[model samples]
Every structure is written in structure tokens, then in C-alpha cells.
Target: MHTPIEGFSKLTKAEKIDWLSENCTTDAEKTKQLLKRYWNANSSVQKIHDEFIENTVSNYYLPFAIAPNFLINNALYAIPMAIEESSVVAAASKAAKFWLDKGGFKTTVLGTEKVGQVHFMYTGNKKKLLQFFETIKASFFEDTKAITQNMKKRGGGIKDLELRDKTDKLANYYQLHCTFETLDAMGANFINSCLEQFSKTLQKEADVYFDFSADEKQLEVVMSILSNYVPNCIVKAEVSCKIKELDEDELSGQKFAEKMLQAIDIAKAETYRAVTHNKGIMNGIDAVVLATGNDFRAVEAGIHAYASKTGEYSSLTHAEIKDGVFRFWIEIPLALGTVGGLTSLHPLVKLSLEILQKPNAEELMQIVAVAGLAQNFAALRSLVTTGIQKGHMKMHLLNMLNQLGATEQEKQQLVAHFKDNAVTNASVKEALEKIQTH
Candidate 1:
């Protein structure tokens, strides 16, 4: 039976682990051993990982890899990727190579606006509140001067502030919608600080206003936070080649072009297909995001929201073959930072940025977008020709073999065997068992 302990966080890491193992595990010694196995042998490196978060356990690691031959906007780059998925790096590399001779990927930053909101409730006259907001709108920026000073000096700061009336949806509900430009940083902290200051200023101005009744002036501040749904913080990446040049030895150019268009259309029309389709794209986007130490979860949430912006979840990548040209592309909103958070702190993240030739935030957005576009192109190319499972399962075979405890020699043999044989769980398991028996 587990009981709550007071001040658990106050305990040392070893002490916390001791208490957790004793109460939470069947064998405390075994749990301790298991946790210690993953710890870095270097004490200084271990210490750095420990301070990254609270209640530190052993470090959890993912494979750090690079996909070379990426030519984005006439600049060649070897993009770094940090992910566990076996096929992602391989697929992105393949896409980059395929497009290398086809003019590579061209990218553009459409917008760089990020958003936040301050929510509050007021039961007073809506029209009066609107008028009051108009009169005090400038004060909102004026009040957050201290917070926005550095950001403003850096060519980024509060863009606009507006009061949104939502009484039709919820009684006495309103929002102070705000937008900002954080320059090269993700700006969550900056945006949030400005929003909190705005919330304070809003309530203060409303309270002291010489309005009608006391009820009209009473404003209840709910919450102030940054929004991850930054649709305006968008970038587009694309590749285009003449349809006649789409020739591969396996399939005719016309057939290949037609099949790809049809595939994308299915993804656009079907939710089931679209969900998986978009996930493939994210596998590429997330790898780069993770390698650069950006917020993948926030990026994921904002992207999925954008996918359903048309009232139905659909493909993020679009393909069109017209006017003798085949164009494939993706436009996604990625709120990324090149200067703050883990970008400068994490060693691998710094290395990853260096590997990318040190792109600023806007350029980083374009590169990430290109990674996703390339990945989708490779996936679609495979799906329309050799089929996804054949290549994906082939890439996944080593992972499965390791999971099943295959020896190195056995893995080598199975790798050769599966080159000609279909890779499935049953097939691999049977072959491994047979190899051992022989």
C-alpha cells in the first residue's frame, strides 16, 4: 500500500529513488540497479541531465542521426534528426536525394505572428465594456513596457491587442486577444509575460473607471497564457518538376504522376487516411524539432489544429500535376526559436543547429518545413509504387530482431534472408527460431 509523503521534492535524487523503489517496486534493489544502468558514466554529463527537470531519473536517450544531401533554397545542408523511428531518417534522406537533381526544395516564410490570450468574465453592459476597452487599449501596451522593452529593442514586440466579445457563446465571457513578434525566439515566455501584464492593466483600468454601477466595473480575471495555435506563424516548402521528368525505370511517368495525385486526393477526402498521412509528415518535422531542442508537443498540437481548420482533418501535403509540371508541397505553422530555451543549453541541440549551418528562426522554420515536405514526398513515392510496408518493415526488422534477442550473427543472417523474404512478425520469429535450431 502506497501512502503520500510530504516534501518528496525536497529529498535528494538518490533518496527520492530509494523511497520510490521501496514503495513502488516489488524489489527495491533490482529497481535501483535498473535505473542506474541508464545513467551516464561521466558525472558532469549526468549532473547536466539531472537538472533538466524535477524528480530526475536515469537519462532516456533517442538515436541522434543526420540526413545529408538536403539542398534547401540553393544552400546545401546536412539536417540532424533525433528520433527513435527507424525509417524516418532514411526516408527523409531518400527524398532529399531524389529532389537534389530536381531543383531541391524551395521554401518561404509566409508570416511570423504568434498569439496569446487573456480571459475574463464581466456581467456588465457589453457595449460599455467595448468602449472602455477602446479607451484603454494603448495602456495595455504601456503597462507591459518593462516586459516588452528588450523584445521591442530586438525588432520584435507586441503587434496588436483587441477585446473579443464572446457573450453569445458563454455568459459574461470575453477574451483579450493579443499578437506578437518574438524575432528569433519562440517567445512563449515573452508573450506570456506581456499577457499577464495586460490582464493586470485591464482589470486595474476597469476597476478605477468612473462607470455606472459597481457591477459594471467588477472584472474577474480568469487566466492569461500563450496559445500554441499559431496559424499565422507559417512556412511553405515545395518541389516542382516537369511531369515528363518524373520517369523511373519501374513505372511510366504518366502512371506515377496519376497515382500520386490520386493518393493525395484520397488523403484529402478521408479522415482515416489523412490522419496517418499527416503523421508521416510529422515524423520528419518532429525529428528536426527534437534535434534542435524545440517544443515538439506544441508544434504537434498547433499543426493538427491547422489540419482541421477546414472543418475536416486532411492531408498536409498536396500534389498537383498540371501544365506539364508536377508540384508537391506542404504549408505548416511552426513556432520555432533559434536563440532561447534548450537551443543554447543542450550540447547536442547546439551541435544540431551547427550541422544545419546555423539558420535563424525564419530560416529554421523553412528547413523544418522542407524536412517534412521531403519526408511526405518519399512516403508518397513509396506508397504509390513499392508499397509502404515493404520498405518500412524492412527498416523496422532490426528493431524487431533486437527486441526478440537475436544475436549479431543471427541479425546479419536474417537481414540477408529478409532481403528476399517478406518481413512480418511471424516470419521473422519463425526464421529466428529455425536458425537457432539448425
Candidate 2:
């Protein structure tokens, strides 16, 4: 039997939660924890203090919304995201709806484990340093073995190792890159700790005129710091459908795909265009990263770094029309989490998770990657056809009227007037007074 879908605004909070739980394999306990984190028994002094620091005074709060009509891996899901940008949620929902109307988004994730990089600098011969690290590679693995002992017991570990040497811009300094897998957790702390512990042994074993520091607090021996950039590693997914419904020209998915690919190519060619191009991608990725309490800043850094890894800034996603079907594919560094930190602590975050039904790490990554691809298409479609500012300015006009203290009716009238007269504060004021008196 076919069931009617309810509009998001029509569903109550509890109904929404119930719908999510019924559709996905949500952890009830985690759902409860999320509610408690966002909703308090009493507005206590401590609660106010925490809110002040984490929210209002500190500007930590972010709005979250559920992108509707996602069908991933043959299952229906209302993907949850935390973001501030307009049109992103709407565009994702629209793209997903279009796919759902055809069939649905098909997705696959590599694994649950995430990798973190540890870098070392050398002033000695690059080839010799590489050979030395290779010689003691097993020992280095053993030293960091305890860090992931539990994960190893569960059959996971440092999956690979990579080393790269490049001359600094000044030509006097040498940069050495060491890449290692941290299994799960953001692993920043663990990766840095392992590098610090290994540096002492590395310096003594190899005759390298180098000093390194990962002491967290000190910056003495540090040339540059942090292991936030993730390279080469990719998380990917695709959505495709037959073009049976729409005519070849009116709303052909194939044409849409071609236009999208062209926009991405143009974005790659210019630095200015690449900024907005990447921003559109981040609009989707960062939301999920924040909702899950993953370090979104790190994810952003890694994404941009990976984008430019080929020496040219480019779109992380690609779309096409192949074999009479519309297809979209994306492979980007999505370092996100399902557990730990404020994910378990924050109240609204908990609510957002409940609304999402708490997908596991791999499932979550797949959904986020899909959302990113959808958002990319949305932006490209707008840029290629209607112009980005048209829809955006329309939405902004409503917000502007509301901010001006216009009543609901007055705001509606103001929007109508602004559409004809152009959106300006002076025009808004004139419309406001005309609507107020008449």
C-alpha cells in the first residue's frame, strides 16, 4: 500500500522522531541522551553559564534542518544537517525529491575508520630519511600499536604509510610528510602524541639535523603545526535515474548534468569562482559535520587541501549523463564522526540526531556525501540557468522585511512591492508605511 508523505511543517516534533525511528535503525538510548542534552529539567544557573559560553555570548548556536526526500541505498531517509546558509536545505530537498520521483539516490561507503596525518621535517638528505623511516616503519607501527589496540582487537589498524619530501619555497627548508591511519575518532590528539613519542627515536636513529615538537602547549621546535589535512583518501557515492518522465529538452536530467559539469570546470579555472564553488560544497558537508559534533573546521581545511592537491582548485563532485541516464559522482575527504564529545553533550545537537535517527558513522558519511553532491548540483543548476542571486535575493528580502519589524501582512506586501520596485531598505520603509496605514 502506498502511503502519503507528510510535509515537514505538518509533523509534530514527536511525530517526526517516531517517523525517523520507524524508518532507520536508531539507537533509542542515544536519542534520549540527545533530548536531555538540549532540554533541561530546570533552567539552572549552570545551564545558563554553559549556554552563555557555548551559545548566545559566544555565538556557538547554529540552526539545523532536515533535508527531506532522500532515498539512499534503497531506504528513505530525511537527512539532518546544521547550517546557516539559505537555499542549501531547500535545494538539497528539491534535488532529492526529483531523484525520489524517478527512483532514489544509490550510495556506498568505504568503511568506518578515518585517517589522520603526522608530518615531520628534515634538513638532511631526503632519500636517506625516507629509507630510514622505511627501515623502522614496523617499529613505528609498534610504538603506535597501543593507541589503536582496541580497534586492532576489533580487526582494524594503521592501514597504510606514505612519505613525501618537497623543498620549501625559500629552497633552504625541506618538508617531509608522513601519513597514517588513526582508525576512528578525530585522532588529532592521538596522532600528535604518537608523532611526538616517535620523533625522539627517529632523530636518534637517523642522523638528521632536525628538532620537532608536538607538546600541544609549546611551539619552540615547531616549524609549522597541526595534522588536519587529509590527502588522497576519498569517500564517494552516486545517484542516477532513467529519463522516462521528462521530455528530452524541458527538464532533461542529462542536460542538467552537462550544465553542472561545465559549471564545475569553470569554477576550477578561476580562483574567485572556486571560492563560491567550494562554499556550495561546504554548505552541505559542514552542516552534517557540526551536527555530529565533528571538527568542521578540520574537515573544511582537509577538503580545500585535497581539492588543490592536483595543483589546481577543482570541484570535488562530477555529474554526467551516461547511457540515457542521469548520474552524479563525488569523492571528497569527509572526516566526520558518529560518537564522542559534544555530540553526546549538547541539547539541540541531540535533538538533531534524534531527528536523523542516528545513522552509524559509515551511513552518516554516505548521507553527507550525497547531500554535498545534491547541493553542488543545486548551485550549478542555478548558476547555469536562472542566476544565483535571483532566488537568494528573494529569500533575503523576506528576512530583511521581518528584521525591519514589519507585521506578517506588511511583510508579505513588502515582498510584493520589493519584487516590483527592487530590494532596498528605502523601498522597504516606503512599502512598510503604505501597508501599515492602508
Candidate 3:
């Protein structure tokens, strides 16, 4: 192993590449070439990408694709998705087309509140500490006026603030629990700045208060941060149609509806099934989140935490056939932004937002939730009827063909041959060998 180099971030890009290739790679020239191959040819664009993160090597690329025919809330949109997976965009598109004739998707914005907290420890009497908190409650807002000014002007700012006692959970633990409205911005930096200022105010005021002994004055500030578990920032999307309308040439409408409902029930009852079920939904959600330049990891964390909010990990989508109607819906927590982060920096992100017709945060939330619901419907539909591998493997065929070094002509032939045949590694290989031998 090579010794860790200090000041690695201080190194120039070319120098950084040199050092990494010399120390970390087997074929240094090949490594360097491959890394530079993915770099943007334009200098300014490359510079922007280099500064996006530390230790810039090369730009990693995912296929940027569009899934068309989404009709959301009486408006139509063609969603942009950046992903490498084979069937995700296709599946979402198919679901969208199926529901397009069934009145499309209806969405509701349930809430838009986000949370933050300032934690501190106080080894003093609870009664006097709470009294001191009451005296200084106004100061928290007063001190954050500068930070909140622009946000307030935009109809978004601190919603509420309160003191929380956590002595039972941990000795001397207390928090300034807070909520905010961030509008079109994700508001991580905004919430964090407010919480930190609140902590500063807490310390400054505690030093001057004359309510108690020296022990009470020495309040230890632990940390200040925003919570990713944004249960309050929620959106719901659903599609419904007459139960008789689910009929396909292969499966009857009532049987199809019954199987779809049973699949949802299994996902709810079994944790193993629920995890995979939710993953399928995220396959659609993360693609759009990434395309629109939002924090997929944070979205993922909050959604999963929400899934387990009932203390058992369960399905994110629900279905029912009642009164001769088949309805499938999903409610998920998504904290997204349209004007901040990579929205302005990444060129593709700008195009994605424009493609979505420049949705505000709430509208983006609705679009994202609808994508997830569509993906789940497509997956469940496949599971109950034709089985997953038939379609998944069909989409997967191209990757296998390329991996086997098949030419474009051979690819076309094999694709046609597999049209009425099953797809597997061995089957594709056998088909290719037969073609080669002939």
C-alpha cells in the first residue's frame, strides 16, 4: 500500500491524476487515458464539474433518457430520468400510457413542513431551565432575522420553535425543536444556519441569566442540524379506473385486479417483500430526483424512515378494489428544490427542470410521487401476470449481447430470435453460436 499523501486536495487536477495513477493503478497510462476519456471536452464545463467535489478524476456518466406520456393533474409531462438500469424508464412509461386513458393521475400535497433541532445539555433544575427558555424564546427568532429575511420575502421562513426536554432519553439532554417552510428550495443550509444561530443565542443568553446556580449557567451545546426524516413534507398520487377496465387479452379484468391487490397485501405483511417493493418504487423516484438535481440519498433516507414509521417496514404503495373500482396509490415524503444546489450548475439538470415545465417544489413532489406509483404498478402487474424475468430479461438482453461482443447485425438477429423465445445467458450464447456456425 502507498503511504497516504497529505495535501491531496491541494494538488492540481493533472498532478492529482498523475499521483493516483502512479500509486494506485496497474497500467498507469491506460488508467490515465480512461479517466481523461470521460472528461468534458469543453474547458469551462470541465472546470465546473471538477469543482463539484474533491479529488476530481473524471465525470461518471449515466444514460440520460426520457419517459414520455405522463398526464399528471390534467397536465401532461415527459419526465427526464438519468439512470443506467435497463427497464426502469420503459416500465414507468408503460404504466403512464395505461393510466393515461383512465383519467391520468390525481395528486395532493398533504404537507410541506421541514424540521431542524438544536441540542444542548443542562445539569440544572428542569423548572428554572424551562422558565429561562420562555424568557429567551423571542430571541431565537430575533437573532435569525438576517438569515430569514430573504426566505421570509419569498413566503418561506421559520414556521415555529419550541423547547424539548429529553432528560429521560439521556441525562441533561434538551433541544430547541424547530420547523420551517422553504418553498422552492430544499433548505438544508437555511435550516442549519438558523439552528446554529439559535444555539449561539442559547449560550449567550444562558450566560447572562441570573435565575440559578453556576451549574445552571453552564449549558453545553451539543449540535445543531436539520433532520432528513421529514415526515411532514408529504405528497400523494393515485390512479383509479373501473375494475372491469383492467382486462387484457391474456388475463380477465377481475382476476387481474384481485392479483394486484394480493401482491400489495404481501408487500405489507412481509418485511422481506416490503424492502424489495419499496426499492422498486425508489428505482423510479431516484432516477427523477437525480435528473432534477436533488439529493437522492436524503430523499431515500426520509422515504425509508417513513416506510418504517409504523415500526415495521412495509409497502409504500397501496391498492384496493372497492365499489367496482380499482385504485392504486402511493404517499411519500420528498423534500425537493427547483432553484438551488445543482439545479443551476448542471446543464442536464437545467434541461430536466425545463422539460418538467419548471415545477415548483410542491409540483415536483407530485410528479416524483406519481413516477414511483407508476413504477410499482408496472412491477406488480408483471409479477401477477407474465412473471418479472420475461420482461426484465428482455430489456437485459442488449447488455448481454454487448458483453458477448456481438456485432450490430448479430444483435438484430438475436433480438428477433429471442422475441418469441426465453432469454438467459446460456440461451443467448447458444443462439449466437448457432448463427456463427451456420
Candidate 4:
């Protein structure tokens, strides 16, 4: 048992590590040294990271990798990925290369609208509330002009506003349903700032409106925040070629396409298959989103919701064989930023944006959707031909070797051994033990 320390956040980095090591770790010195080992050597760079979050200890690192040969809309790109999972980048790269000559990928931005709401409960008469909302709606926009000015200049801001009544769903509940075009910025701050101001303006004006009864004027303003489920902020990416173009080493093009289509059909019909199918797509989307300093969690939430928009969860990617043309595509909701948040702050993020030639939010949206589609294609291709584990385990072999503390020579030998043999945790361990005993 350990006593809790007060003002843990106020402690110095060294002190925090010391306390954590003493209380939480068996070997305090080892834990302290290990945590400090990940710290940036440059003070300036380290300081930037420290301020990124509270109770800072040390940096957590992930490989910032690239999947090149992606040809989208006639332009070539090498998309950056930041993830820990093995073979995700390799799978994406393989897909990119495979599609390089098949017209690569075609992408389109479907929408750029983001959503937010000011939720409240008013037991007042519905007629009076509706009347009051109509009169006060313009004031909401007027009050948020200062916040929306810069966004408007960029041809993006306050696309729509409406009064929504949800009394039928939840008693006396009402809301200000609002939408905005945030352009290259994810605009959470802008949307929230506007919604908050709308809340203030609504309450103030309601207090002064002449038609309202005493209770009607007592408008309760609930929390105002941006909605993560931005179905309107979506992008579509597609790839297509003749059926003959899908030929793999193990399967003919026709057989591979049929098997892949069958797998996708199951994903569409079954919840379990759909969830895992979408997770693989996220492996690619999230990697690029993280590398570009965008919010992957929001992107993920919105996309999963969109998947169930038809009343049942289903596949994000769609496919068909039309007139001997084999096509696959995905339309996903992705609210992303290229100029704000960590994009301008994190060094690797800035470098990543430059590597992709600095795409705007819409452009970034397309690129991310393509990454997801490419990943799904790679995974389905493998599943239809060689199976997912063979390649995945091969890519994961290095981590397994490291876990066993195998020397360079041992790793080399084992890797060659696994080339003709199946790689598994148990198999690798057995092979390593045999090499050691010999």
C-alpha cells in the first residue's frame, strides 16, 4: 500500500518520475532511468512535448513511416503513418504499389459541414418557444460574427442554424442545431466558440423578448459543444480495374475477386465481421491522421456512426464488378485539420504535412480515405489469397525476436528459418531455444 501524494502535477519532471518509481515500480532506479531514456535530448524540443499534455513524464514514440507510390487524382504521394502495429504500413505500401498502374485512386470530397448544438430544457409552451427562436436566430449569428470573421474570409463559416425541438424524444428538451464549413481547420474551437456565444445570446435575448411568459423567458442554456459525428464532412476514394488485373500468385483474377467480394458481403451482413473490417481500415486512417496531427478518435466515432446510419452497422467500403470492371471504394467521415492544433506545434507533424506536399483539409480528407481503401484492399487481397497471418506474422517476427533477446546472428538465422516455415510465438520460441542449445 502507498499513500497518495498531493499536487502531483506540480512536481518537477524528475520528482514525478522519482515518486512514481518509488511507489509504483519494483526497481525505482531502473524505472526512473527507463522513463528518462525516452525524453528528448534537446531541451527546446522536449519543452514543446512536455506542454502538450498534463502530468508530463516522457515521450511515447511510434515509428513515423511512409507508404509511397500512391497515385491519387493523377498526383503521386507518399503518405505518412504513425502506428505501432506491425505490417500496417507494409500492407498499405503493397496496396499502393498494386494500384499504381490501375489508374491508382480517384477521390472526391463529398461535404465539408461540421455540426454543434446548444442543448437546453424549457418547459414553456411550444408555440411561444418556436416564435421566440425565429426572432432570436439572427442574433445568434450576429453575436458570433467576431469568431466567424476569419473563417468567413476563407469562404468557410456558419453554414446553417436551426431551432430543434426534441420534446417528443425527451421532455422539454430543445436545441440550437448548427452547422459550419470549417475548411482546412477541424474547427472544434471555432464551432464550440460559436455555439457558446449562441448559448449566451439565446439566454440574454430570451430574457428581454416581450412575447415570452415569465417561465418562457427563463430559458435554461445547457452545454454547448461540437458534435463528433459529422456525416456531412465526408470523402470518397475509389479504385478500379478489369477483373483480370486482380490476379495473385495463388488465385486467378476472377477467383480472387469473387472471394474478396464474398468476404465484403459478409462484413456487410454480420456485425462481428463489420467491426473487424472497419478496424483494419482505421489502422490506415488513424496512422495518417496521427502523423498529420489530426484527431483520430473523432474521425473514428463519426465513421462508425455513419456505418450504422442505415439502421444496421455495415461496411464502409463498397465493391462491384460492372462490365468486367472490378471496383472498390470507401466513403468515410473525416473531420481533420492541417493548420491548427498539433499540426503547427509538433515537429514530426509539420514534417509529415510537408512530405504529403501540404494538403488542405479537403485534400487531406481524400488522401486519408484513400489510405483506408488501400489498406482494406490489401487486407482483403491477402485474406482471399495467402491469408492475413502469413504476411502479418512475418512482419511481426522482429518484435518476437526482440522479446526473446535474440542476438543479431540469431535473428538472421531465425528469419531465414521462418521464410519456409510458419512464424508463430510458440514456433519462434522453439526455434530460438533450439539455436541456443546448439
Against the hidden reference, what TM-scores do the models get?
0.97, 0.74, 0.97, 0.97
Predicted candidate 1 versus true structure: per-residue lDDT over 1-438, tens digit per residue: 999899998999899889989999999999999999999898987887888898896888899999999989999999999999979999999999998998999999999999999999987777788889999998998888889999889899999988898889998899999999999999999998899898899888887873647344457789999999999999999999998788877788888989999999999999999999999999999999999999999999999999999999999999888898889989999999999898887889999999988889999999999999988988999999989999999999999999999999999999999999899999999999999999
Candidate 4 scores a C-alpha RMSD against the true structure in Å of 1.4
Per-residue C-alpha lDDT of model 4 across residues 1-438, encoded as one tens digit per residue: 689789999999889998999999899999988998999999999999999999988999999899999999999999999999999999999999999999999999988899999998787778888898888778888898899999999999998888898989998789999999988899999999999999899888877864556444457887899999988888999999999988888988888888888999999999999999999999999999999999898988899999999999999998998898898999988999998899999999999999999989899999999999999999998888889999999999999999999999999999999999999999999999999999
Q: Kindly report which residue pairs in candidate 1 clash with one another.
A: none
> What tens-digit string does per-residue lDDT give for candidate 2 at 1-438?
325566844665555555554554367556545644664446663364344332221123467788888888778888778887767788888778867866676777654444444444445556666666678766667776677677567555556555544445533233334454444455566556656655654545553423333432111123323356655446787876664543334346556557766776787688788877888888888887777677888888888888888888877877666687766778877666556656676766667667667766566678878888888777776777777876666667766777778788777666676675655567667778777777
Q: Mark the 10 consecutive residues where model 3 has the least summed lDDT.
A: 209-218
Q: If both were scored by lDDT, which would come out higher, candidate 1 or candidate 3?
A: 3
* lDDT leaderboard ranking: 3, 1, 4, 2
Off by over 4 Å in 4: 210-218
Best model number under lDDT: 3
Query: How accurate locally is residue 423 in candidate 1, as Cα lDDT from 0 to 100?
Result: 98
Model 3 stretches astray by more than 4 angstroms: 210-218
lDDT of 4: 0.92
Which residue pairs in model 4 clash with each other? none
